[model samples]
Target: MALSDDTMRGVNLGGWLVLERYIKPSLFTVPECFDKGLHDPDVCTNDVDDAYPQDQWTLTGLFKNKDDARKYLKDHWANFVKEDDIIRIKNAGLGYVRIPVGHWIMGDISPDEPYVDGEWGDFVRVVKLCRKHGIQVWVDLHTAPGSQNGFDNSGRTLPTPTGVGWSGNPENVDRTIKAVRDIAEGIKQEGIEDVVTGFGVLNEPFKGQNEAQVKDFDDRAYRAVREVLGEGTTVYIADMFDAERFNGFWDDEEHGNTVLDSHYYHVFAQTPRGFSPRQHIAYVCEKNSRDVNACCWKGGGAGGGTSVGLKRMIGEWSVSFDTLVCTKLDDVMDSYREGGEVLEFTRKIGEKRKKFLRNFAEAQMVAWESQDTGVSVGWFYWNFKMEGGAFAEWDYLRGVEEGWMPTLKAEEKAEHVFGRCEEIIFRTDDEMDIVHEFPPSDSVAPDWQAVEADDDVVVSHGESLLTKGSRERGDGIVLGFLSLVVFLLLGLGIAKKCCVRYFGGAGGKGGYQRVGEVGGVGEVA
Candidate 1:
C-alpha cells in the first residue's frame, strides 16, 4: 500500500491543551488567584531572574505523579477538551487530531504518582471525540519530562541542565521508551484507534551532546513503541539534530513500522521575524517545493535532503504573528486601492501583503505534497493553540474551523474557512498532478479584500514590509549600490592580474622593454 492516506487530509487540531500557558490562566481559571502574585502570600515574586528559573514561565508542575496528573487531566477536561475543539477538527475536514501530551500524563516522567490508572480517560475522551466525528487521532508525546528538548516545549526539563543523551542515564532512557509504549498499550486496550492510524514517539528529539547518543535514544524508542503495538501501529519519530541524524532510518531500513516526522521553519536563512504567519507558511512551502527539484540528491536543496515524502509532509511549521491579521490582511484593513490615498499609503502595504498571502498559502500547499520522503505520517505543527502569546492562532483555527462550526453549531462561517484549506490541498495534492494546475499567473492571484481593516480587528499587516522593495521599482537601491561596488572590486582584480602595467625594474639587472625593441636578436633599447 502507498505510505500515505489521502483521505486524512484537512485542517490540524493543535494548541488546545498545552498552549494555555501552563494549564491554568488567572482570569480563565475558575479558582482564580484574583489577587496579583504581588498581593498573594502564597506566591513569592523573586525579581532575581536566576533565582527563579524560566520554569516560572509556566504554572504547571515540574513533574506530577501519573495518577494525580491523570486526575488533573480528567477534572480539567472541560477546560482543555472544549467542545469547540472537536467541532473545529471535524469541521475543517481534517480526519485526524494529533494531541500532544506532556510526560506528566504518562507515569514514567512523573515517577511518583505516575500516569495514574484513570488519567488515561482524558485522552480516551479525545480519542472518542475523534471517532465520534469520524476523525483519526494521533497521540504525540509533546513534553517529555527531563528535556527531550531542553526548551519549554518539552513540558519538563532536567531539575538541572544536563547535556544530551538523557537516555544514557538508563533510567530516563527506560522511562521515555516506556512512556510511549504504555501510551500505545493504553490506547489499544481502550479499544481506541490511536495506533490504528499513528502515534509519535516524542516531540522533536533534542540537540545534545553526541550523534551516537541521539541514535541510541531513537533506536530504543523504536524498540519500545514496537513492543506494545506490534505491526498494527506506525511509530513516528521526530527528527532530532536535524534530518541527517535520522535520515539513516529510511536508507538503512533498520526501522520498521515507523514514519519519520520532521519540521521546517524559514528562520534558518530568511529574514528573522520578517515573515508574517502567511508569509512564513508561503515561504516554507515555496522554499520546500523550490527545494524539491533538488531533492533528487541531498545537500543540493536548502534543507539538504532528497526524499519525496519528506518534502511533501514537511511536518511542523509556525510563525510569530497575528493569525487573523496575516491571513486577512487587505480585506480587513481597508486598502488604498479601494478608497483614500493616505489610507492607501497607510495601508497600501496591506494591499501588497494580501497578494503575498494568497500566493504564499497556495505555494505552501504546492510544496508540501510535491515529494515523497518515504514518510506519509507523523507530521504536526508546533501547536494548535496558545493561552496568551500569539505565536499562532492554531487553537482558534482548530476551534473555529474544526471545533465550533463543525461540532457546536455547524456554522457556515466554519465551512468557508475549511473550504479554503481544502482548496489549497486540492490545488497541490500530489494525487492531483499540478501539471494541469492553473497557469502560474493565475496560480498566484491577489485578494485585496482580505485585509481591508475592519476596526483593525481582523488584521495587522505587521510593520510595513516595504511595498516598493524591488530594484527596478527602486527597492534595493542600497543593495544595488553594494553590488556595483563588488563588481568594481572584481574588475580591478582582473586588471591587476591580466591588464599588466609594465614598469622599469633595475634596467641593468632586471631590465624590461617592449618586445621587439628590447630583444637583442631584434633591436636593443
Candidate 2:
C-alpha cells in the first residue's frame, strides 16, 4: 500500500537507538577526558576506560566489554527516547519517524557484543509509543552484520575506511537477512503492522561495491524480506547510491509492493561545493525535483515499463551545508574573528545566519512540495537531535523553532500539491499496471508484441508471424542459403547440358581422339 500523502512529512529518530559519536560524543567516555578532570554531566553517558578503543567509535565500542554495554543499554536505552519525544514529533505536525537501528538490537551480532535480556523489548516499547501518539514508524536496519556501510553510523568501522561491507562476505549477508526476517515477524506478532510501515532490509548495503554485487545482494535480500513480510507489505530497499539499478527492479509482477529509498544530502558531494547559501538552496531543490521526476512521476517512454506501482521516498536529508558558511558557524563563531570583538561578530553572523538557513530550508521544502517533485512520499529530515556542539542546521526541531524550518502550517501545502499532477499511485490502492500517456517507442517495447483482438495471425512489419511461444523474428540466413544452393545447382545442370550438346553428347570422345593421335603416333600407339 502507498503511504498516505498526509503521513509523508517525517523526521529520523537518530542518536537515540543508535549511538553516533558525531551525534552524541558525550555518550562515549574517553580516558583523555578523565585525565583532564572532565566528565560528561549526563548520567546516561556510559563510563568506561576506552569506549572507542582502537579508533572504532561506534555503539559496539561504547563499553570495555559486552556485559558492560548490555547492562548500560538495558538501564538507559529507554530514556534516550521517551513518550515526550513522540509527543514532540506529533506536535511538530510530522506523521512518520524513520528509526535507525542496529542488528545487535535483534541479537544478530552476539558473543562479541550482545543486547541484554530486555534490550530487544525496548524497541517494542518505542513502536507502541509511536502508535499511541498516532505516528507511523519506519524501522530502518542501519547497521547490518559486518557493517554494511563501514561507517560509524552502521555501528562499526574498518582499520582502513574502504566501504567494503557485508557484501564482501556471503555469511554476513545471510545473517542480515535472518535479522530482517526476525524484525519483520516480531513487529507483526506484536500487532504493530499498521503502525510500523515496513522494514528497511539493509541500510546502504553496498556503498562502494560494483553494480553486479549490489544487485546480487539486493535481489537475495529483497526476496528474503518479501518472504517474511508477504505481499502488500511496503518494503524499503536502499539504492546503495545506485538509483539506476533500482529503476525497475520492483516493477516485476511477482515482487511485492516496495519503495525505493534514496538519501539526498547536499553537503557530501562535490557538485554543490562553491554555491552561495541561496544557490545551495536552489541547487538542492532543483536536484531533488529532477530526481523524483526521473524516478517515479515521469515515465521515460511506453517502451519503458509503466512506473505506476513504483514509489520513492527520500529516507534521509539534511539542511546543513559543507561550505564556508557552515565552517564560519561552527565553534561559536571562531572563524569570524579578524579584528572586532569575537562576540560582536558572532551576534552579527548569527542573525544573518538565521535568514540564510531559513531561506535554504524553505527552498528545499518548496522544491520537495513543488508540483513535479512533490510526488515523493515525503522527506525525512536527517535527524531529530544531535548532542555534540552540533550545528543547529542539522537539528529539525531547533531549525523549526528558530524560523529556519517551515512551520506545520507551511508544510501542509504538500498535501494540496498532489492535485497539480494527474492522480498518482498514492490516490488508489488497486494493484493495476500504470501506463504513461506517451507509449514507449518500438525499440524499447516489452518482448511480447500486441495483437488485434480479431486477428488469427499476428503480422509484424519485416518480422515473422509468431505462435504462442515462438520466436518473434524468424531466421533469414537458412532461407537465403537454400535459395542460393538451388540457383547454383540449376546453373551447374544447364552448363553440363550445354557442354554435352556442343560436343555431340556421348560421341564427343571418339570425334576428338583421332585428330590428336595422328600427330603423336610416333611416340605412342
Candidate 3:
C-alpha cells in the first residue's frame, strides 16, 4: 500500500455518518419540539433561541430513550448514503472518498454523553460498498470527545462559537487517541486495508487556540495508529489552516507515508468579500496556486529531497464563493437575510453565475493538478451531494448536473479546461501588457521617489530607475559563474561524494525508501 503517484480526485462523504444540520435539515426537525415549543433547558436558555436542535448533541437529547435515539440515527445512516451513491461515485471516476466519523463510532464514550451508542457497523458497511465499487477510503475522525472546533460539524455546537474544550482537557485528548487506535485496529480486523488506505487522526482542531496541544495530539495519535496499521497505511494530519507552518512537520526519518490535509474555502473570509467573478477565478489561479505549490515543495530542488517530499492534498474545499454565506455566525442561515431582502438575489444572476462557477472550478483544478508546481496528491470537494440540492454551489453532484463541475471523464481531457483562467486573465490586448509588467501593481500605480544628493555620494534618477534591471543582471552573472565552478568540480571528480551526500544517494541518510524498505513497514500489498 505505497503512496500512489496518480492524483486523487475525490469527494467527501460528509453529513452521512456525521450529522450536519445544514447538510440534511430534516433530521434536525422535531415536530414536537417545533409544534409544542419544547426545548432543552440546558442548551436553550433564552427565548430568542430556536426550539429545534442545532447539533447532534441537542438533536439526540430530544429523544426520550437511548433505544429511540439509536434507532433514529441508524435509520438515517442506512438511507442517507447507499450502494447506489457509491456506484455513482465510481461512475464519475472518483477513486477516493473521505468519510468523516464521530468519536463515538466505536461505542467507547461515557453513557452520559449525548451521542448515539454506536455507528461502527454502518461505517464498515459503507467501506465494504466502496470496496465493491473499486474506490479507496480515507477515514477521518471528524469529532473529538469534547467539541474540537465548537461547530456542529464537530458533533457539538457550543453556546459561544469559539468556546473550544477538546485540547484544554487532557482526558479528552487521550480519549481521541484511543478512538484513533480503535479505528485503525477495526480496519485491520475487517481485512479492508487494501481499500481503506488512509486515516486522518483529527479534523480541523482550532489552530489559533490549540497549536501546541494539537501538535502533541497529532504526534501521539500518529504513533498510536502506526503501531497498529504500520507505515503501509497513509496517516493524514490537518495543517490546522496553516500549511506554511506545518509543511515539513513530519519529514524526519521516523515518519513515512504522512500527508498534510489543507482545506481551502473562499467564502468564509473577508478578503474575497468584494471580489467580482473574474477576481475570484484570478485569485485561485494566482495566489492560491502559489500557496499550494509552496506547500507541495518540501526541501531543496525538485526530486532532490528525501522520501518524496511530505505529500499534501486539499482535503476539503467547495465551489462556493459567496461572502454572504458566512460560517462565523451562530446560525449560518441567518446571514442569508440582510436589510429585509433575501440574499438569494445574488444567486439569481442566472446563467452568469453558472458560467463563472464553471470557469472557477476549472481554474482550481488546473492550478492544483499542474505538475510544474509540485507533486500534489489530490483534492476532494467538501461534499459529495447535499440533501435536496438546495445549495448547488456546495454540492458536487449538482454542479456536474448544472454544467459547471467537470466529471472524471471530462477531467481526462482537462488540457482544454486548463487554459480557461489564462483566457480570462488575458482576454484583452491591454491585459496581455499587464502580465508582462515587471513589478505588477496592486490596483495602483507604482510610486518613484528621488533621493537627495549628499556631499560624499551622488544620486542619479537614471541609475535609480535601473535598480531592478541591474540586480537581475548581477544575479544572472553569479549563477553562471557558480555553474561553471560546479562543472569543473564534477569533471575532476571532486564533488561526486559531496553531491551524493547532499542529494541522498544509496546507503546515505535521508534517502528515499519504498514501502517495506529498511525504514518502512512490511512489503507493499
Candidate 4:
C-alpha cells in the first residue's frame, strides 16, 4: 500500500531498451527506394547517406523502423538489473522499478505494422527477475503510439506530443488511445499482471494538453484497459502537457486503483537568467519553470490531499552536470559520479548548483513521503541502468561502473542493486542501507565495437559517453511554492532571498539600512 523507497528510485534501460539515442546527421535517408517522406521533421529530411545538421538532432536518436530499434535493444541491451544492483536499489528499502517503454512498440495487435509477439518479452523477463528479487515493475509507456516528444528522443516523428497539426480528430485520438489499450490488454493477458505494479499512461503528455480532451482520452484509455484486463489495474497519467491542467483526475473512482504521476528537473532554478553555456560548452534541459507550471496546480505539492488524491510518482531525476564524458574512451563514468578529473569538468553551474540540486532532489523525495499528495506517491530516478557497453551485439556491463554482469551472478543479487540509498540519499529511511559500485574504467575493452560509422567510431547512442560522456540524465520534480518567487543566491551558494523587492524585503518597507558588510535598499519611509 505504501510505496517504498526502492520503488522511489529506479533506473531506465535507455537507448537499447527501446528508443535509439541519436542518429548520424549524414544518414538522412538510406537505400534507393525507402520512403524518405516518412522522415521526421525533427530529423534532417535528406538523403540517408547525407549528413544532417549535428546540433539539431544530437540529443534525439533517430530510428528507421521499430524492428531496427528492437534489434539493437535485444542484442546490445544486457541485464544491468543485477543482484548486487537490486540489493543496492533496495538499500532504501524501496519496492518498485519504473521501466520506460516506447509506445511505438506494439504487437500485430499493432496497427503501425510489423508488431512482434514478444516486443517487450525480454523486458518482461527482466521484470519477472526483478519481482523474484523483490522489485515491483511500474510500466512507463514513455512515448505514445505516435512520438510524445518529436525531437530525436521520440525515436521518430510525424506524430509527436505536439500533435503535428492534425484536425482535432477525436477519431484519431481514439485510435491512438486504443493502440495503447491493446498493449495494456496484452500485458494483462500475458499472465504477468502481478509483475506489473503500475502503468504510466503517456510520458510528458505536454503538447496538446486540452484539459477536457486529456481527461477524456485518459478516461477512455482506462476503460479500454478494463475492457481487456478487467477492473483493478492501477493507471498512471503524467501532466507535463498544459491540456486538462486540472487536478480533477487521479484514481479511477469507479474502479478505484490508479496513480497520477509527474516528472521534474531543476536546471532552470539552478541556472541564472540570461545564462547560457556561452562561455562553456552548450548544455541544457527541459525548463524547470515550465515544469513548475506543469506540476503545480493549487493542491499539487505538499498537503491538500483532497483536490487531487491520486498517487503521483516523479519517475526520473538527476543533477545534470554540463559534463564531457571520460577521456579514456573506454571506461568513462567509471570515475565520474564521485571522483576523478571528470568532476572538475562538470558544469559551470557551480557549487550553488550542487547545493541547490541536492536540496531540491532530496526535498521532493521527503515531501512525497511525508506530504499527502494523496494524489501521487513514490518515484523512480530518471534512470538507473546506464550500463551501455554491450559488444558483438550482446555484451553489456556488470554495473554502472563495475564489470560484473548480473545475469551470470544471479545467486549474488538481492532486492536492491547498485544501492541508490548509499550512492545518493536525500533522507534515509532508518530501515535500510545503500551502497553503489563504480568501476575504475569505462569498461573492459569489448572484443569489437558496433561502429555505425568507422570514421567517428561512436559507441552507445553514438554518445561516446565513455569519451565526453554526459554526467547527467534528466527526470524528477521538486514541489515547493518558495521556489516560485525567490531567486537562488549564486554568489552566496545557499542563501535564498525574496524576489519582490530584490534589495528591500526583510528591512521595514522602504527602509535603507546597512548591516555589517551587507547593504539594504529599504528605508523606513
Candidate No. with top TM-score: 3
Superposed model 3: Cα runs more than 4 Å off: 36-50, 159-164, 296-309, 326-349, 409-417, 424-525
lDDT of 3 by residue, 1-525 (tens): 667767788899998888886676656665434433554333332233355577888888776666667876787888888898888888777889999999988877677787875677878898999999899999999999877877788888876444258888898888899999988999999998888999999998765566777888999999988899888888888877677676556766577788888887766553343344545554565456556655634453334343343677789888776532323222434433222432232332256566667766776776666555445678888889875433557888767767777765523634344453333322211111111111112332322111111111001101111222323446566545554564466446354333322221122111112212121000100
lDDT of 2: 0.53
Better candidate number, 2 or 4, judged by lDDT: 2
Against the hidden true structure, what lDDT does model 4 obtain?
Answer: 0.39
Assess every candidate by TM-score: 0.57, 0.67, 0.73, 0.54
lDDT of 3: 0.64
For residues 74-110, write the lDDT of model 2, one tens digit per residue: 6457777789888887887788889887776666656
Residues 69-131, candidate 1: write the lDDT tens digits: 334345555465666666765565455567776555545534332223344566677777777
lDDT of each: 0.41, 0.53, 0.64, 0.39
> Model 2: residues >4 Å from true position, as ranges?
5-7, 30-59, 62-64, 110-118, 159-163, 270-273, 297-306, 323-349, 373-375, 409-411, 415-525
Q: Where does model 1 exceed 4 Å of error? A: 5-58, 62-75, 109-119, 157-165, 194-196, 252-254, 267-270, 275-287, 290-312, 319-358, 371-379, 385-525
Candidates in descending TM-score order: 3, 2, 1, 4
Ranking by lDDT: 3, 2, 1, 4
List RMSD in Å for every model shown: 18.4, 24.6, 14.2, 15.8
